[model samples]
Target: MFEQAYGRLVCFADGQREIIAMQWKQGATCAVHDHGATASGRVHLVVGALVEERFSFDGQRLCHTTTLHHVAPCTIEVPPGLIHRMTASPDATLTLSIHHYEPCIASMRIYDPEGRRTVIVPDDCGAWIPEDAAAIVAIEPWSAP
Candidate 1:
């Protein structure tokens, strides 16, 4: 079964684990964010292509670590607390992927490098800031690699 959640499709969910489906339009990018500290997951790209930016967060600053370009038919293991952002390849009409999380993500921390701020948001918001935007929890600087 599937339902909508955080602008994506929730393929399945139980208190301990969940699977989500994401669709990306050409040139679309998700916010930089980390899966909850206790959650670990894998992202399986089913179609199209994507560009992924990985980051590291020290207590005081967020820093870009590396970037990767992935084509479809690939899988990425997401370590706990890994911070990253994903963008659909500009040449792709659509990009699709499935994400599986254990202990299902309860909340996530989104980083805004340009604004130098970080916000704690509920899982329903995915890696994006919600329209209400009353969830800011930290203000920190960021640096590029």
Candidate 2:
């Protein structure tokens, strides 16, 4: 389970004209389980590592899992057109100043995969829902959703 959270800054699609700041603490993360809406997404990390776990959804089925670890002061880009699942590091206290330079909307969904059903938590909300991503996918890109 994610015992640590993430800090976020949002940028629009047309250009960098918006600066929306969102932050969370330990044992928290965006539970929407998603990624950007384009082929390229960029972010300037100020602090903290954002732990992202990737997955493949076959419409009615969710396949594979990959856990990506990203530290602060770093820029992460997901290849254009890939459905992604992301989460913040569950390590400890950390912070990140995200400068959304290229206009990317990162989303994530949280659930207890080992539980009874699919628990898809929407974006813009923070919650602690941890499942072993490696148990579902094969590669861990180590970035945010």
Best by lDDT: 1
In model 1, where is the ten-residue run with the lowest total lDDT? Answer: 1-10
TM-score of 1: 0.86
lDDT of 1 at 119: 71
lDDT of 1 by residue, 7-120 (tens): 488989988999999887677788888987899999999998988999998755778999998999999989988999988888987789999999798668887666766777
lDDT by candidate, in order shown:
0.79, 0.47
Q: Which candidate tops TM-score?
A: 1
Off by over 4 Å in 1: 1-6, 134-145
Write down the TM-score of every candidate. 0.86, 0.52
Model 2: per-residue lDDT, tens digit, 1-145?
A: 5453455444333543334454546545554344334424454556666776666754444455777777776876655544454454567465554434234333333433434233333333333343544333222222222
Measured with C-alpha atoms, the lDDT of residue 22 in candidate 1 is 89
- In angstroms, the error of model 1 at 98 is 0.6
Which residue pairs does candidate 1 place in steric collision? none
lDDT of 1 at 48: 86
State model 2's lDDT: 0.47
Report the C-alpha displacement of residue 140, candidate 1, in angstroms.
7.8
